[model samples]
Target: MSATDDVDRSSWLSGYSDTVEALPIELQRNFTLIRQLDDSAQELMDDVASKSLCLMNQKTVLSPKERQQRLANIGSLLNEVLKRGEEKFALAKSTYDTVDRHCTKLDMDLQKYEDEQLIGPTMGRPSTGTSTAGSDKRPEKEEHKRKKRKQTRGRKKGIAPEVDEGQQQGEYLSAEDAKQHAQSAISLSNLPIDPNEPLYCYCQQVSFGEMVACDNDECEIEWFHLECVGLRTPPKGKWYCKNCAELLKIKQKK
Candidate 1:
């Protein structure tokens, strides 16, 4: 090859220009989805922790309904966490399978190229590519199987790494299991909140400090935080959140 071609190839070998095509578009898209799902799941976990802390507050008095509401929120969060975990696992598994297929293809292609380049009178070069491809197929298949088993053999011999992680974290698949865990955790702290019931706010947070209640009785989530509404204090007269105001306007026109 020319000197320019040699220089370009040498640069690639030195890893100076390798990143541009390092990942395929499909893999990049999958990675983005994975990260988004992970961030959302982490936020849900934080919300669960924050709500749990609220339930543990000894000074704050919550009515039966309010307490039930908080518990119910935690339960919903636990269910969502499980759902996200399962989704991430499935997506990762699909990505793994795709990579496996690509690797096997790469192996076969390499064998063909090697057979072509090493051209000589080795049992006739016309059928050499076919012979090499055939010979490499069994080894490629066996290597794929070996790698799969090696990666997954740790957790009960066939479970994926993701499954092993979930098992290690106490197997909390639903709110019921979480509620039980909370019960055990609360016994020492003497927290009165059950891990089940439900609440009313756009933020899904415990009603605290200063909050404004919508005048409309029909409002699904009747409460709003002053900070959330961009107000320092409650409105002087009847205050309605944006949704409640729209509903009231509709009612007035009707």
Candidate 2:
């Protein structure tokens, strides 16, 4: 795996190892206390058992005087056992309390570290450079609206059309002839024109309807005056009206 993967895995592994290792050291101290208490209790129990056995033997088979003496000895040993057991039980309870307190402290420390590392960076604060104050602040809403407007304008206009790098070698014509030819044969598609637009006559230099229609006599479109056509230059070489340009793109696709 890559270095990043190794580092991520190691971070988690190390944290878990630290937590587990801490428990053993803590448990060791508590267990030692528990063992000491148990040893004391066992010693007391052994003393009581040994003394009681001696007393029984004396009463059953030895003289009556020896039995009385052995009875006192057994009673003393029994009292010591009971006393030792109580002391040991108290010590074991104290050890448990100490271990419990330590564990609680460790848990709290771990929780604090977790909160600081995981939650702090995301929620604490935004970076200074990422935000601005007062009227200079750019509102997110306006920024989105600006982007949308730019995209809409882009959709309306194509990028600068490609111009022919080399000059055309086709038959040359006088400016007037070029305009006349352009006017006569250019029949437009049935697309409607706005009536208020001026229509120019190719021969008479007269404008009629609000459009420049071509002179295919069968055509429904108006023609531009020859002078008007010559006066209007192509943007570089490629020339098309808004609707014609859109149509050209569709034809190119086929």
Q: Report the Cα RMSD per candidate.
A: 26.2, 41.1
**In model 1, which residue pairs have backbone atoms overlapping below 3 Å?**
68-197, 68-198, 69-198, 71-196, 72-196, 72-197
TM-score of each: 0.38, 0.32
Score candidate 2 by lDDT: 0.51
Candidate 2 lDDT tens digits, 95-158: 5566566556567766766555444444556655443332233355457765564345333432
Give the runs in model 1 whose Cα sits over 4 Å from its true position.
1-23, 58-60, 113-120, 123-254
Clashing pairs in 2: 197-210, 197-211, 198-209, 198-210, 198-211, 199-208, 199-209, 213-222, 213-223, 214-222
Over 99-189, each residue of candidate 1 has an lDDT whose tens digit, in order, gives: 6665665566567656644443344445667767766666687778755643443222222223212112112135564455345434523
Candidate 2 regions with alpha-carbon error over 4 angstroms: 1-37, 59-69, 124-254
Candidate 2 residue-wise lDDT at 76: 75
Winner by TM-score:
1
